[model samples]
Every structure is written in structure tokens, then in C-alpha cells.
Target: MSKDFLEHKAFVELFDLHYGNLVGFVYGYVRDEEVAKDIVHDTFLTFWNNRKRLDLSYSAKSYLFTLAQNYALNYLRHLRVVEVNEREVSQLLEAASDELAEYDERYARVEEKLAQLPDKQREVFLKCVVEEKKYQEVADELDVSINTIKKHMSRALKFLRDELQGESILLFILSNR
Candidate 1:
């Protein structure tokens, strides 16, 4: 076998040996299984990219844990931003309740429909609408591709449209509002 192939095999073995502990380490910080998995995946990506320069003397476990910790911290910062944005939108909606009653009712219905979506789609939709985050930002924060965000948003709109057909005018007003 070629030297490169041998090295790659070794890397795979090392990754398999470390993956579970790395995921546990990440979960300790992030407290979410999906997010922890993503962080561990990213750590592997980083390790692969830096393979030629990697210091074999340093424990692979240590490096993976450090990467996971950094990623988790960044994720927490993104969550804080999303929380602040949600609060701002909630305040705006509250302030305009009298003028936007019909619109708000339609929006409430749409939101109820949204809640039925799979978790990821619902999260993307809420981040886009209630938090006013751009699709790219939402995708990055969710560790999903931009195309996934678009698909989620498109499905969300379709669901809302179907559910709110009789209330078209109210829906349009709410969309604008």
C-alpha cells in the first residue's frame, strides 16, 4: 500500500478511537447532542486540514476538546444574539398590537402552524421571521447549509400560505408588518 493510504488509514483509526470521548467533551460544554456532534465533526475537519502540521506529541484528545470548546463558546454567543433579537421583535409586536390586531391574529395562526414543523425548520423560520436574521446567518448559527435554510424557509412559507389562505389580506399585512 501507498504511504499516503497507510497514513489515511491510521487517521481513521485515530478518529474512531477519539470520536466518542470528543463528543462527550463537547456535550459537556454545549449540552445538546446535535450541537455536540456538529462540534466534534468540525473538530475532525480542522484536524484533517492541519494534518501535515499536527503535533503528534500533543494528545489528539486534548486538541479535539479544545476545538470543541471554542466552537461551543461561539455557538453560545450566537444564541445570545438570537435571544436579543427575539426580545426586540416581541417588544415591537407588543407595541403595535392595537394597530396590527388583524395582522397579529394571522401571524399567530401562522406561528401555530410553524410549531408543527420539524425542529430544524421551525427554528430556521422563527429565526428568520421573529428574530429578523438573514438566512445565511441562521444557517451558520444552525450549522446547516444556506440551501438547507432556503428549503426550510420555502417549506415554511408554503405551509403558512396553505394554512392562511382565507386570511390572505391579514397574512399580507402581517408579512409587511
Candidate 2:
């Protein structure tokens, strides 16, 4: 199957057949209705993109469900990580004696942490998170798709969290300044 093949009636037929049940199944893992739908849609898009490489031996339903499962698991994992990070950060902030010193230290730590990212990830992280550039603006400036910029930002954040784990000051400077 090719991209052109995905345009064929059979693909829409397959989508109609599988999408609802798959979304319901995905909702079980993802909990959030909107995110579950998005995951299913993204899985279908992936299937369309890799339609040429997709194995005929396996059921498309199974393939899509598997993709949804993987996507949901990853989403859950990232959500868990973010929750933990935020919780720890709140605790740390509460522990701080002076807000000014804490913010100043966090500003310096963010710089040091960002320096640890790869060039592209670093650039994406700084532009999007630090400079607070819009994703579209960063994508335009970097000459990449918004999706590519988002991927770089995700990787950069995960890398920063892993490297800066257990630090008193959060890796990111959460203040508007």
C-alpha cells in the first residue's frame, strides 16, 4: 500500500470499521477523551504514512490498536513524569527561604541545563521554552515543521529532567521574567 492507496475507498472503509472501537479501547488507557481520540487519529495517520511498509500478514485493526496502546503508554509515562516533576518542584519552592534567590538560582540553572542539550534540541528548547516563542515562529525560524520542533522540544525537556534530577531548583525557570 502507498500514500495513494490510502486514498482508495478501502482505506476509508477500514477506518470506518476500526476507528470507533479502537478509540474506545484507547480511552481505557488514556482516560482523557480528547487525548484518546487524538491518539487514535495520530495512529491512523501513522498507518497511512507507513502504509507501504505495513505488513499484510497482520490485521490492520491489531496494528492500529498496538500503535494506540504504545501512544497511550508513552503519553501516560510523560504525564507521570511531568506530575512528579511539578510536585517535586512545588515542594522545593516551598522549601525556599527567599523567592528572589530561588528564582535567580533557577535562572542560572536553566542556562546550565539548556547548555547540556544537543544543538537542535538546545535551540528548540531555548526558543520555545526560554524565549517563549510560538511553535510556529520557532518552526519558521528553524526551517522545520511545527511537529519537528515539538519533537525536539520534547526530547530536550526529557533530557533536561534526566540530567537535572534531584536538583533543589527546577530545571526550568517557571517565572514570567
Cα lDDT listed for each candidate: 0.82, 0.83
Look at candidate 2 and tell me the lDDT of residue 43.
Answer: 92
Cα error, residue 115 of model 1, in Å, equals: 44
lDDT of 1 by residue, 81-159 (tens): 9999999999998878865886566678866776788888788877887678899999889999999999998997787
Off by over 4 Å in 2: 1-7, 97-177
Query: In every candidate, how many clashes are there?
Result: 0, 0
Clashing pairs in 2: none
Task: Output the number of the lDDT-best candidate.
Answer: 2
TM-score of each candidate structure, all chains considered together: 0.52, 0.52
- Residue pairs with backbone atoms closer than 3 Å in model 1 (clashes): none
Worst 10-residue lDDT window, candidate 1: 168-177
